[model samples]
Target: MTAGNPTPDTTAEPAPGPESHPEIPWERLSARMVWINLVRLVISVVPGVLATAVLDTPTGPAWPLLVASAVGVSATALACLRFLSTRYRVTGERVERTTGLLVRKYRYVPRDRVRSVDSSARLRHRLAGVRVVHIGSGEARSSFKLDALTAATAEELRRELMPDAAGEPEEEAGRETLGPQPGPHEEVIARFRKPWVLYQMFSVWAVLVVTGPAFGLHWLLQPFGVDLLELVGELVDYERRGFWWSLALCLAVAYPLGFIGLALTFVMSHWDFTLVRTTAKGHPVLLTRRGLLSTRTVHRDETRVRGITFREPLLWRWLGLTRTSVITTGLRQGPDEDSAAGVLPRVRMWEAREVAARVLTGEPSPLEAPLRRHPRGALTRRLVWAACGPAVVTGVLFWLGRTDVLPDRAWLVGVGAWPVTLFAAVFSYLALGHALSGSYLVVRRGAVNRSTVALQHRAVIGWTLRQSIPQRLGRRVTVRIPTPAGERHYVLPDASTRQALAFIKGSTPQLAAQFIGEAESGGRRAAPPP
Candidate 1:
């Protein structure tokens, strides 16, 4: 590799021999994949055994063994068929895979359009010497997978999909070169240690979402005549406990469960975290690699990047941690791949500034500037909007109480409901704010969890002035800044139109000029560009 380009060294490794090849060019998955699939077959087969037991069906040893044999034979045959059917190849321009024995299927992705390449292996897959390869495109929800491949093949595919570090092929005096020369190899900008990964895992309180699995299990068990609540109460004896004791018991049970889930998710998604910066066609490219069980590697051509987002959640902000995401075109169609695209999954706030300065070269730093706060009317609007739901509920309750449809104590519901509603209203209102500083636009929003996005002005594709009746009455307008990256829309929920316009004009004058001068014209009349 040339200056500033550093290739990963694997020189000591031996190459795969012809004996390992199934064909001249195409490749098949590791034999261990068959064993892995057999295990999966066992897992799927267990439910039937359990169902038989639950139904109190009389079963002989021979009958159960027969069932097992039938399922095993079918699963083993299917696994063999799939292994035989699947094949892949990597060439100069494209990577392709073919699968299915009877109903054949084929998929090919051009090397240039490849946005991300990742590999993952669960416990069985790891033991079987195979990994699942995940390939993503720039379009939303466009992803493909190779069910199983050896580690060597996965690496080879990754190299094939990525542009060469040496730069694209160049013309000699007389003839064309070996291949398009690759851009300079990327340099490591940052890498997270185990401690940092731990911090990031703790930063997200996914434990709070643990109720999803618990409740799902509870509902599923209900059909089997099991009262999940009674079972749990029997174990913990919550009825006999005092308020504080119950609280302590719940916390004791919840915290560890939450930690395990969070830790697993963090490790699976962010193992061996590394970030790299390199140049392609003279523009920067950001690459990320991480994942414990399922490794993911993603690359972004900085030339296609429109801006960046700096996110700080409440708990994370207190720990001085932030995540940095990129905004780019051709990214609007994905199914929330922000986690995959995060350049800084977990970095200190100061580190974010440093990385931003490096990655967003020549652009203004929005973090250094003070954000402009929305007018009081914005807060009032949120409060009113939030209050409507509670007010309607309270009204319904009062009417029901007078008509004897509900108990006289129904009025008491508002005592708790009103306070919670007000809190949400006030919190949500307080969370809304926006700022425009030079070539950057910073938006602050979110009620329970706070998010602050700092974006460059050039990324603002169009300006939308949205006003509801209440917003109009309050002399406020919602400004939406749409970009092609991810699902997030940078919005200033309730700001003065004057401030919004001024901010847009300052950040992207071209877009503002068109919006102001031509946007106001009658639909029938075409307004030329300024």
Candidate 2:
């Protein structure tokens, strides 16, 4: 045979095929997920069965129901198995996901767009020798989940995906810690050191436990023709056989027990809790711990942070606990998504401020300083008008009762309306006072929900000062500042023309100059007066 030609016998001997692809270790969902799903299935089926039995539905179709449930469970189990059997191959350049029997899906997630990689192993998952890896990419703005990976494989995958490591001597490896390592500009400004477990349990009880049981009891008793208040009275009598004595005893026992449960839950939730600041591939990584349940690590691009807010809820204030969060661009709407967007786990308010100063602003501003706002009466009048709705409704109800247009038994309307009016008036006054108190508009805007609005001095994209028909009649103005990303506008519902102009001048001097220049140019173009 010629050098390029193969004989029939040579072809039959099997010519070299393309390079064999590496085998990807197939993985399944962690046993924990399986267990959790199983539990959910049981919970679903048991409730349906119980509900059917309670309603005395004909049992004729019971077999079908059972069969359907089993089929569903099997289908889900098979899907998870298929996922586990699927393998991902990561080369020096790209990540590829290949799977499916009849139909196949092959996706490539380039390494350059990957913003972060996270691996987690819950206690149950650890037992099952599985871990979940989350891969986040900026381009697609989505995250990929890889489950049931062996710990070693996870580490290998992480190493492969990690951005090119800074070339450092091998000797430096031994000095580095397993957790995040900070950059030169970043530091752990403060540590939130608390008896976390105690605090967590207390927080859980105070926030949720009491309300849950109270609501449950209220609902359960209502269905049985029982009144909660009456039942409570009876229980009180049973305890001491005397009304006053029983009341005192119940209060004494309930308060301490409630507090104990609160304390325990706090302890459990905050167990081994720690917050750390580190530079991950040059971005600030905030690592928080709250018990062994799971460890949450958040990474933020410092440039994307729009505002930092530190809040101390009334209850947590006493315990020296504070919640901190940031406002950032590209956030999805809704509290849950917003929470995922920029929320930091609850921490001491002071610590939050300190961290913000160090990471966001480079210098700490006093956390207690009151915010700035527009003139007081102007803002208050608008708030008062808004608050008057409830009062007006209450007044109408009271007038109808007094006029006997409604039954005399409805006299309670006037009595109830008194409280409603007082509440509305107080709220209106506070809202108005807050509006008028320029402190509310101060650059640092958040106490409970904090936001700071500041524009680069030279980066003003557009400025508009407008007055609506009502606002014009009322001599009020609304100021809008538009940036490339979006607009930040404020309504000064009541302000004179001069006051509005002056406010704009003080807030954005450059914007005022631009506006004045435009006005002067427009005046020049106007036809000469006759």
Candidate 3:
């Protein structure tokens, strides 16, 4: 048998027939999803009722509205219940998921093509003792929740699907030591907190929390025939109490109150935060966490990562924090309908560089390299000059506006145009500095994140040296490497003519020499075209 072929063990049972798969208990399986959906259905009906009330539309009978809401809720609940009753089976060779009430749908994932397995349990799911599992292939992925399965069974299923120990002994199945364990130096690489939760809470009560409800109530009363601003002006008359006294009181109370609300929001969203590294199914597992009310988990295949990037915003730098992300090959497209790409979320910021270096690069240099930009001063200066046109235009416009030479009506145009130019110049400078000071592509074989990539000089699909017209006039060039996936370009936008030619020729001799070598080898000599 071929190495990829599955071998049946003596303990294996007869493969289940198409119609005989075990039934999934609908109530047990999807209780949480159903409850959540029911709550959502009720919430959705409220908006409709509110719209009806706001418009004062010709009213249907109260009973009809109630009955319609009931029917809508019931239909949605039934659909979810039916979906949960689907049965799935995984054998040595393939995975089969079967679902339907009358006409069933079957999905098959062959064992060899299965790339990764992910499992997650939200708060609600944890209460129900269930976890959602996703099985991924390079081109497609599938997900299902196995309700109330024992943890042992979940681990068994993971092992069967992924089969990490292809040649190891069967007796080692239960042992954790079968795989390479992380040393003490290794640490948690990535983490996440639900920022949207904090954002939502802040949006709802920011005004009331920051300024006392008295102020909010006053603002709220404006639509109901109250003129609080005029009343306040009269009450705080300059003739009576001094203006400075009232202003001082407002500052003393309001500013600190605003900060208190912001602090509370941040704390609540990230309360009980925990990020840890552990071995699961003989692979490094990264577990991230946040508040007790909501939890999220992401699983990654360490071998699949192409690179890791650490980003530090100016604010984060001041706070000694760094956000880390990995560049992987494949992921599902989100609901917003972008092209299929990889998942890259902002992990925790504090003490991130050390953790990221240990997990992502196998050495600490990757994170440190980008932070040291002094070595590339010459390269950065040239790039800044090449990309500074936008910034110059922006500065000029700002100067004009400040001097009242540009009309206030055109303020937005000046506002929009200046930032783009300024940002471009800044980014160009940073990229050049990174290439010179921080540049090291440590290509290695069988590293967890950075693995060896095979490239044939003769198989150079395409190459280009490009420069903007202005850049060309300045004698600059940007080298582009085009592969099947897309193009990767590096802009050395301010090299001298001799330097540009030599750099291009040296870096991409394979592509440049391919045509020349082919012509000489084939004896296809010809006069230069006139």
Task: For each candidate in the order shown, give its overall lDDT on alpha carbons.
Answer: 0.65, 0.48, 0.45
**Tens-digit lDDT track for model 3 on 1-530?**
00011236778556554554345322233445566556658764753464345434343223334444566677666757564767667755666676777787666566665655555555545655555665665454344334434344555666777565524222121111111334354355434455523322322234456566656556444433565666766766645667898776655556666656765655554555544565545555444444445443344444444444444444334343333444443433232211122122333443454555555544344544432232243355545664465456666766777889985444456456655655544554543322211223311111111221112222223545556665556555554433322012112334444453443344445444543333334436542331
Which digits, one per residue and each the tens of the lDDT, describe model 1 over residues 73-92?
A: 68767877888898877655
* C-alpha positional error of residue 44 in candidate 1 after TM-score superposition, expressed in Å: 7.5
For model 3, the local distance difference test gives 0.45
TM-score of each: 0.70, 0.56, 0.50
lDDT of 1 at 201: 56
Q: Is candidate 1 or candidate 3 better by lDDT?
A: 1
**Candidate 3 residue 436 C-alpha distance from true site, Å:** 7.4
> Whose TM-score is higher: candidate 1's or candidate 2's?
1
- List ranges where model 1 is wrong by over 4 Å: 1-32, 39-113, 140-142, 165-235, 242-248, 260-284, 289-298, 314-321, 330-338, 346-351, 400-408, 518-530
Superposed Cα deviation of residue 381, candidate 3 (Å): 14
Query: Predictions ranked by lDDT, top down?
Result: 1, 2, 3
RMSD of 1: 10.5
Give per-residue CA lDDT, model 2, range 1-530, as digits (tens): 00111225543333222122455443344345566456546754753464355434342233434454566577657746666456666654456565666676555566554544566666656666667776655333344667656666666666667542433111011011113434555445444456433444444234344546765565434433556766776767764477677866766656666767776654554445444555555445444433435444444443444444454444565567655555343322124212333344455555556665554554334344453343455545545654465567656776787898976556455556555555544433332211111211223322233333333323233556666676666665555544322123322334455564564555555546545444436446542321
